[model samples]
Target: YRAFERKYRKNLKALYLVHPTNFIRLALQVFKPFVSAKFGRKVMYISDLSELNQHIRLDQLCIPNAVDEYDAQLLAKEKKPSAAASNAFQLNSTENGKALLETQQFGVSLAFIKENNGGEVIPPIMKTCLEYIS
Candidate 1:
């Protein structure tokens, strides 16, 4: 992990877990001292898998039947524009405009889908509150 971080030059985020039922017994028998010393207040134990699943979407393990094949294909086809070209595209066009307005609109729509699905956006009204704090 440290080697990967050095190569990438980025901090890592991860979700760590132990089986809920076995964790308590194992910690008591063998891991108590180490866990207590290492995590202290940061360690949290949740007893139910259902509760954990509420926070995490286990999409690979349980695929939704409602997602149609066409929709999946459409999503897979979408791509992000290269960083250099992204901001060069025009949003508005006049008759016989030189810019590829359709491609730009598609890129913007793809960005919205990616950002929203990846939990990147805040609602516009709530964003005003965030702006004041920052």
Candidate 2:
């Protein structure tokens, strides 16, 4: 950021940061002196994914899986992961690179994935909260 601020700062218009950690916040504090008022006003800090959607849609960016992991924790804060939350769906693979099932559950539903031709059905209480699947 410091390097870019010195050279290409004028070329930039708006800047958005996602899930800024403590270290990033500290770095920005240190960098405040170097950034000019005009450019500094354009800098925006996005604390959550939904907030970022206002500026740029999720489809526009290829967000990493690690971001999702941080998201769950961010929402719950200090609460521990419940049993249902921990295993809403179990992922198995035909190959190491393969994902088992793609599910998009709206309202409420269950996900029953049978592997190796095994006759396993989901229990009545196995409702899922998954909104998207890929």
Models 1 onward score TM values of 0.24, 0.48
Per-residue error for 39 in candidate 2, Å, reads 2.1
The lowest-lDDT stretch of 10 consecutive residues in candidate 1 is 9-18
Candidate 2 off by > 4 Å: 2-9, 78-134
> lDDT tens digits, residues 69-100, model 1?
54355445555666656554433342244534
TM-score of 1: 0.24
Which candidate comes out best when scored by TM-score? Answer: 2
Show pairs that collide, candidate 2: none
What are the C-alpha RMSDs, in order, of all predicted structures? 16.9, 14.9
Candidate number of the best lDDT: 2
- Clash totals, every prediction: 0, 0
Q: How many backbone clashes does candidate 2 have?
A: 0
